[model samples]
Target: MFLNHGSFGACPAPVFEAYQRFQRELERQPVEFLALERRLPELLDAARERLAAYVGASPANLAFTTNASSALNAVARSLDLGPGDEVLLGDAEYGGMQILWAYVAERTGATLVHRPFAELAPGPRTRVVFCSHVEWTSGRVNDVAALCRLAREAGALSIVDGAHAPGQIDLDLEALGADVYTGNCHKWLCNLRPSAFLYARPEVQDMIEPLVISWDFHAPSFPERHRWQGTINPCAYLTTPAAIDFQAKHDWPTVRRRCHDLLAAAELGLEPLTDDYVQMRGFRLEHPDPPELKRRLYEEHRIEVPVFESAQGWVLRVSVQGYNDEADLEALRVALAAEL
Candidate 1:
């Protein structure tokens, strides 16, 4: 009953085993895997093909990264923004993404503006709005098509963080219409640890630079420039196709809907805290005696639902994934009932 797939995704057993096999193959012949291998690029291309098909994008425009944070950094660090340029973001964005932009603004003197929901009506002055497809901390799904319209009207580029959306929502990246989108395969796709992708429209990809300028920096190919960042574990990226297959094998959409139902039922008081949502139920845990309630639920009951205090009130985030079942939800509810 891992409720916190948002923190670090839980890889399915098959996917984990596949990753181990990749590592084993690498260890079997490091020289072949890294240097002498003739088939590595072809293999990568196949993985990219599968990913592009899943997300509705061209394989050439997508680049694999460790996570959404790193993907956002690559985009943030590359854009040539100076003192006058502005990057509008929402207050509800993940903390890591905000920090990435903060670093860029601090060094380059570009203004990092928070696009207030109050003023979010179709406007014409906002520059490059960075938003999440789904609010991570709060399960509020956004109308991305509408937001894209607003950004286009403002002559702004849109960067969408879709960490919580891949497995939870039905997405067509080409139709989503954001200038750039980043999502985690490890989280929703149930891949091995830290596998994620950044998708940029073909025109946008050239402007975006790789985070780590390795030997591929000067290469002629798009994948070379961004893909070969460092000599870290590439198993996660390599085995993503298997993860996709795993989802397909299980009829992922039905499983996702079932999880959502279970989570909604378990959520006692938590309510939506943000406007863009995909997975997780952000309930208003405004019930009296919140602290003692959560403590007893966790300590005495061994329930593992996430409860935190927010501006709205005490909020409990309930999540259901393939690895979780009704028993897990019932246990959490039982524990909460005891405390509440």
Candidate 2:
């Protein structure tokens, strides 16, 4: 049984097929499909429009990127950080994103502050605040909208890393009001890998530059410049609509509710870290050796779940998707009991 949906999501068969169809079409007519700039732009625009509506943003402000990391990188590099500038970050932020900001601080001589939550008071030198909508380690959901409001009031920009929020929860970018919001379509959205988006408010769009300098370098608009980063396999990006359609056709809200219930039940006895998680939950484990226990669960029981060390001791995260059931959770419970 697969229980690690939070790590890398499993795409449904229909969406996978649609992704393959796009790939085949691209391979059949590489020049005709990808080189015809006018037609390609229209198709991309249509896809972005659908995605923007789904995420509660205007298509003009959204740009597709390989993943949330790439989108965050664009924002991180573009920010005018310098000596004496400070960027506030939540202590529970994802490790990869933390590394990116750390690199920015190292190169630009800016200070990066890590606080336990987003309720910190910004100092005079604080230029921006970085936080996650849904924390990866604890599966905790942060009040990003409030954080953004706090940042704006303090004369700081807000960048929300929403890598786990797309299809897991209903998102309204306008309601969130963050300066820059980046999220993954591949996780809860059940899209193929290398598919995600970045939404920048129109006024703040100019602050971001494309990670790759390409033919669209001189493009008049922000989306135009960043959306067409040097030609690569755009099949995953093109198939995002199909993924969204699949979820809609299957009544995904109901499925998500069922998954959330399963996750809640599975978290019994283990300390609940978050009250806002949907399909995934994180629990504090008493096991001294979580890594060995995780390995043994997979090897001896043919179960797949994630257990890792965290600030709050060992953590065992469970992801319940449409494919999961009570039996899967029971298997995990049995395995954990035996292994631990």
Best by lDDT: 2
Q: Best candidate, TM-score-wise?
A: 2
- Per-candidate TM equals 0.90, 0.96
lDDT of 1 by residue, 173-282 (tens): 88888889999988878888778999988777788889999877887656667777778778898888999889889998888878777766564533456534445767
Query: What is model 2's C-alpha RMSD?
Result: 1.4
lDDT of 2 by residue, 1-340 (tens): 8999888978999989988988888788888778736457777888898999999998888999999999999999999989999999988888788899999999999999988774655778889999989888888888888888888989898999999999998989988899999999999999999899999999899889999988887888877888778778888888889988999999999999999898887734677777878888888888776788888888889989888876566788888889899999998888776766
By summed lDDT, which 10 consecutive residues of candidate 2 come out lowest? Answer: 35-44
Model 1 lDDT-worst window of ten: 116-125
Name the runs in model 2 displaced over 4 angstroms. Answer: 36-38
Tell me the number of clashing residue pairs for each predicted model: 11, 0
